[model samples]
Target: MPNIVEPKLISGNANLPLAKAVARRMSMHRGMSVGLVDARVERFNDAEIFVEVYENVRGEDMFIIQPTSRPANDNLMELLIIADALRRSSAARITAVIPYFGYARQDRRTKARTPISAKLVANLIHEAGIERVLTMDLHAAQIQGFFDIPVDNLYAAPIYALDILHHFKDVSDVMVVSPDVGGVTRARELATRINAPLAIVDKRRERAGEVAEMTVIGDVTGKRCIIVDDICDTAGTLCKAAEVLMSKGATEVHAYTTHGVLSGPAVERVSNSVLKSLVITDSIEPTAEIKACPNIRIVPTAPMFAQAILNIWNGTSVSSLFERETLGPIYEGMYSAA
Candidate 1:
């Protein structure tokens, strides 16, 4: 028998489909083991949460597959409780594979009284007995520092890059865009891999969930533009940026983001926007409205995620995953025209 027979990966109600997909890749079979109960969390008459883990998880290397996305509080609590339960049951090593880590945007406190909720969330996980974390495209990368345990910040860029290259053939007409100034580095990384020119969307924030239109830093007129972002929550920034680009005479607009934390009317907003299509990885399961819309395309990150899981299982260096950006330089010419 193989030394690593199998890691007993467990899933809560958060996003069963994504968890199942990940399981299918890791385990030859995708069925959940018996006795693993729903860690069923519910609200009381007074409105507090109750958690229950109905299984005996002794000496098991457990991986809890849950994305702390929308209903952020509840999901976050669910993860914490599940971890607590597993720890009590003597699980050898518990790994929290949260494809989407919420409160990640609050890594830096904007106001004097504001709290860095991301750090708090990490602390909760640590106290709950999570040995390690596996997540993708955190809103703020520094949130990893909040925890002392090993964290595998997987990259979905390579998957997106491959998809773009597969779907689109013409290179000259394509341009990758950063929806806001902050996401320029991520956008540049993806832009470099495709051998495409990069564009930046310069905008000011009038308030949260609202962006003040400023200017397009790079020329996108008549080019097939793909906006690369880490998270797309309300879709306000994305839709607004798409509109700004379209108004500036961009030929077409498409977006590839890692986490689709589509909260509220985000699906409706994206469907009705000027964007030709919005593609997101399965970090957060799509809402009902998102599935009903034809404009949204979901590309699978299963292959890369599966690879990362295998590498971690074998104790391999996953840093080579970022080779797309470091292996070759994409910008070759149009340098000395000035």
Candidate 2:
């Protein structure tokens, strides 16, 4: 057999902490020698992005961990620049481990002249020489097809289920809630995994990021409700849904989201809302305001990202990470040890 190419992990300024954590986990797993690539991604005085890889990457497999979160344009540019740099260095293959895919909300055009920015972004990644993409909880599932290359979309349902079971010792009175009808499928999967009933919040959006009115569809009376969604930007929908759930007699309201794009007044809204707690992953790095918010809690996704990187590097089954029982223990062990 030919010698296996050791994977090289690199990251942009977007969520560097998550990238470092993933590198640490990979290094600790089975005595693997994986580490972050010696790369310097910086911005020029005029705000132009520059990337310089210090170490040799020729014939090596590369995983770039970058989330196009806040300052989406800058972060996205950094990713593209880094990928171009790595490709020029002749890396064997480059996989973008985008924990939170930005521009994803614009996957489709709802109006006459609006652009499908997600497809444009996907094409840009392809042109930048990314061989594959690994993202979690995309806003729209069909965005995967926009890429001609292979795309692996991971779910955070397993992580949420484990956290929920640990938090609510007895889940007998728990209910999974989807803030909008579009998210019923995602919420239902989590509900099924945890053996709980599913609820949907019927809301009409007068415009993007604005919810007109919300009504609870299912009976949440006296139940601990957990709202599940992919992104939590501005948080108007989540907050409104929680308020409606509480009015409908839900005992408590909690939120579990994959990408906490807590932009603008999101932190303030979540802090002042009826939500008992907001659990999010480290897909987007939390700001100081988010950290100081008492009700906000974050679960690390580094272990899962590390495992996925290793699996893809070794040509293993990336989908198996979705198994609840298996995912929980693995996440706990790696996270606890780290």
Candidate 3:
């Protein structure tokens, strides 16, 4: 029989705590010792990135856990360089476990002269010799097609549904609201899981950073509203949506998102907004500002990611790990895409 190569986990500087958590979960689930590979990633005096893998990965299945978050350019380059180094070391296979895939919002061109940066990023990863990719809740589902390699796009509805159910005992009083038209499908999935009604926020974007107006479509009067989306960047859309929901007689408005990019003035906006609270997964490492914001709560995605990675390594079906019956149509769509 051929030698059985155990899976190895490697992490970039993007989010070390999340990587450690995933490693611990994997070790616990497998009933064996699983540790991260020693890979030093740093920047030179001139700001040039350098990567050095201290251990041999020859004939090993390497999984690199790196989220392309803030300082996106630097973090992105770091991931690419690390993958290139692993390829040179003859690792049996390289899978990039990107919990938060940056540049995903740029999957298409809104203007004539603009570039589809997401596709370019996908090409770069393929050029770096990555064999597969595992990501969660892409800004645009179609972004998966940009990659030639197999892409697994995980959904956060299952996790969020559980949390919402636990927090709100009376599900009938709670309603799921999509902050914009584009997010209706995502909100619908969560609504179906929690058995709650659905609402949509009709908003027109005048420009990139500004939302011209917002109108609530469904009845939110006296209802506790839960707004759902994939990413929370500047918090502009979420904050505005919450305010509109409240003005429309929503008793409370809470927001949940998969990835919290939390860019400029996001924390400040969220804190002052009418939202009761904002819950996000730890896909991107939270900054000091995010941590200090009392209204922001972070849920862990490590356990889910850990299970998915293990299934991939063991050549098992990952969709089995989630509740297909509860997920319904979303599960069917994701499976077809995979």
Candidate 4:
């Protein structure tokens, strides 16, 4: 038999709670006894980041969990430093598990003299000695191509599907609304899963940090609309889209996003908007203001990510984790009780 290597999980300071949860779930998997690797990540008085791996990681497969969310630059630097530390420590392979990849919005240049920051970040990771990347619901699917290393970009559709089924007894009354033309593909997937029709919000951006105007493309009359997207920033777009849906006779509006990058006035906007609820995964750590917002609901992505990590470690296909049948038990046990 060939030599078998067990994977070691490590985490940066970006989101310790999420990392801990993933580690706990991995430990629960049968025939797997993986544990979180000890590490110290701190900052100097002037904010220079430092990382030190406490235990032996030599010749071991290592997975580092870190989401580049708020303070994107700081968190991103931390991830890179941690990956560099692992590589220098002689880890067999290093996979950066970034659940919410920041700087992904700039995957392309809309005009001249602009940089593709996403590709730059990808190159940085590659240069940092990472062998692979595991992320979810990238803003643009093409961003995966930016990385030369193998990247597994997972989807939150299955998780949203399970949540929809749990909340809506009659799925026929539901409609999935893409907040913009770019998100139609994502919305369509969820719509197909819930057996609902699709709608789009045609909106134009007048300038940065604002949405000029929006128009509803399909009828949402008398339906419970769920607006789907990958990221929720200032939420100007989503809130505006929800208003359009409501004006078009939708009874209620709900929003589901994989990463809740609720910056600026997002929480305030969502709280005052017509949206009945806003659902987001724990891919990014919630701020105190986010917790205080009653309309915001957080769903755990730990079980799904835990399973994906196991599959990758076992050299098995991770795609099946996105299937509802494969995730039925996990979804039922976790969300059905909520």
lDDT (Cα, tens digit) per residue for candidate 1, span 1-338: 12334466677667878777776665532344322334566668986666666665677667888888777888888888888878887877889988999889889879899998899999999999999999988887788889999999987777677677667856689999998789998998888888899999998888887776668998888999999999988899899989889988899999998888888888889988999999998888887777788999887665455556656666787776666442112111211111
How close to the true structure is residue 17 of candidate 2, measured as C-alpha lDDT? 93
Q: After superposition, how far is residue 256 of candidate 3 from its true place, in Å?
A: 0.6
| Superposition TM-score, candidate 2 onto the true structure | 0.96
> How do the residues 193-301 of candidate 4 rate in per-residue lDDT, one tens digit apiece?
9889999998888788778889999999999999999999999888888988999999999999999999999999999999999999999999999988999999899
- Say which prediction, candidate 1 or candidate 2, comes out ahead on TM-score: 2
Task: Give the per-residue lDDT of model 3 (tens digit) for 22-44.
Answer: 99988887899799999799999
Question: How high is the CA lDDT of each candidate model?
Answer: 0.78, 0.91, 0.89, 0.91
**How well does candidate 1 match the true structure in TM-score terms?**
0.88
lDDT of 1 at 291: 78
Which 10-residue window in model 1 sums to the lowest lDDT? 329-338
In model 3, residue pairs whose N, Cα or C atoms come closer than 3 Å (at least 3 residues apart or on different chains), thus clashing, are none
Q: TM-scores of all models?
A: 0.88, 0.96, 0.94, 0.97
Output the worst ten-in-a-row residue range by lDDT, candidate 3: 329-338
